[model samples]
Target: MKKKRILSLCMGLFFSTLLYSQMVGIKTNVVMDALRIINVGAEIGLSKKMTLDLYANYNPWEYKELQMMKMLALQPELRYWFCDRFNGHFVGAHIHGGVYQAAGIDMPFGIWPDLKDHRFKGHFYGMGVSYGYQWILSKRWNLEGNIGFGYARVKYEQFECKTCGDKVGEGHKNYVGPTKAALSLIYVF
Candidate 1:
């Protein structure tokens, strides 16, 4: 019910914005010192100074011994361009809503009776804000970069087995710290 409504609303917004002539772009980035993050993002310009962006990311790490931790996220954002050109540069702000998954945690309240190989899954809601600059490389291409901070709250779920089985109950809650760093990219129309 609620998930359907959310998906429908996102689809509606995505299609409704396609009526304009805008620049489209894709970006990729890797995060350092952490669990090795891989990020991909897409953007559609609403105007010269405003646009919408959708993004996703993944992080892979090891939990304790018998488990692995993988985190995935999807984010949609509204960006406001602050400067059109400065030394052949562009600047903007990105406000984002993020959804995420965290895997391989302990089952809450020992939901599983045996507790042999039960796996845990977590869902999160998050937000991010970033300021960035793009340097023009050609007529329709540019090099872009940004630094940002983000936070997330997660609720976990319990599964009896690694692959298939029964789910016990709602999981646990986690508060994630902010992310601060840079993402560089090549933009195109």
Candidate 2:
């Protein structure tokens, strides 16, 4: 099946990268965790100053009958370290894709004015650029912070409330603003 093929390809890529990488880091974004979203990421050193990073996050719980923040997201980035891999400053280019179901939430910056009164289920895809800093905490741990800004093309179906299945509107939106933010704990090897 298609799912099996995708899983197999991902496993092969992961293992093959492990074989040749100079270093690998496993990380979790604490910001996402604080919001009850589960997230994990890996950074594979491709060269002395370059690395590939992959990150994924998911949330599936509803807080109340009409309050929810449920979604799955993935982002992959290529980074160039200013000093050395996992050391100091870095810049990256990344692509992101995700699906979300949200209701009764007040989004920051008034990005989605109707979210607090309506429910939305949608998928989005986009790209962005980021700047980040990583601080070595010890022999095998690090702290990292990053922020990115760019564009997302969102397509969604709107409903009156979280449990209301009656679709009211559906359309495409072009969004521009902050795309990523992370405060992460990383274990390096």
Candidate 3:
């Protein structure tokens, strides 16, 4: 129910922004790709100093062996740039929602314990503010580096088996930490 509402709302915003913006662009998050997750996004110029970015990422490979992550995330952000439409320093506010499954991984900062004999699956959503820098490579090429931090609320259910997924328990976590980190390669049109 909640996921449906959020997805509908974001889809609506994506379409509306597509219809209104004069300049639009496509981007790939290299950080995600390097980690075996697929990521793509669109950027719409909103004003002389502002832009809207909508991005989605997914990890489709096996989580247990290599990546240790299985998830899908949708993030939309409004950015205020300091110089021009897509260059220089910028600040952004973003909201994101996603589904995740984790198991047998000892996450950094005590974010996750070694679920050596179990797994967790559930949803999470949060908002954050970020600072970034964009460099112009050519007339239509750009490179961006961004890091965001704020809060996250995760709700998940434990499973007896990482593969079979037999439910055992449920839990929630509140975190104050990094929510987004992106190194994007963008193409403008």
Candidate 4:
């Protein structure tokens, strides 16, 4: 959150010093997370060639008590206008990463072993980059199409239990995998 604020401030200062074309908008996507996510977010253009964005998502996973995961992501990117109408565009490879957590589940470990008195928790951190294109419909309304790839590392730890058997025993399981691809839209304000 603080990082986003600082990036916004820096962009504001940089753009304020020059007369550059800029706009803001909001975006929504239904196929963000394996078709289990609906995302609504906002974006800002610092110039005709640069953009800064911050957004959040509600992801639904049906395996635990916290069935929905919420995330906050901040991205600062550079773009090149391929045309004058904001129609054809190219966005450079950008770095976007943030914090998020999964909900509902009491155990992070795989299918509970044969333990009857043990439980666990699974938490994670992720970072990645994406490449894509943007098509501006107007000053404030634009449709963006991009493919984003990233990685997420999950921390799984065991809890207290006596009958935990070999299934729910104590210990840690760390999972690192590709975060997934993002096909989303954006509304610049």
Q: Tell me each candidate's TM-score.
A: 0.58, 0.92, 0.89, 0.52
Clashes of each: 2, 0, 0, 15
Candidate 1: clashing pairs of residues: 156-171, 156-172
lDDT of 2 by residue, 39-69 (tens): 8888999999999998888898898657888
Q: What's the lDDT for all of these models?
A: 0.58, 0.90, 0.85, 0.49
Error of 3 at 72 (Å): 1.2
List residue ranges in candidate 1 displaced over 4 A.
1-19, 30-39, 58-67, 85-119, 158-171, 174-176, 179-182
Model number with the top TM-score: 2
Q: What is the alpha-carbon lDDT for the whole of candidate 1?
A: 0.58
State the displacement of the C-alpha of residue 94, model 3, in Å, after optimal TM-score superposition.
0.8
- Which candidate, 1 or 3, would have the higher lDDT against the true structure? 3
- How many clashes does the backbone of model 4 have? 15
In Å, residue 10's CA in model 3 sits off its true spot by 4.3
By TM-score: ranked, best first = 2, 3, 1, 4
**143 in model 3: Cα distance from truth in Å?**
0.4
What tens-digit string does per-residue lDDT give for candidate 1 at 1-189? Answer: 765676577666655665453667765654432446667666777677776766666666555655555665566667677764311333343333334333445645654333346666656675667666777777766666666666656566776665567888775554444443555465565
Compute the lDDT for candidate 4: 0.49
What would the per-residue lDDT of candidate 4 be over residues 76-174, giving only the tens digit for each residue? 444454553234655444444444433333344653342233444444455555555667667656666655555555455444433132434334333
Write down the worst ten-residue block by lDDT for model 3.
60-69
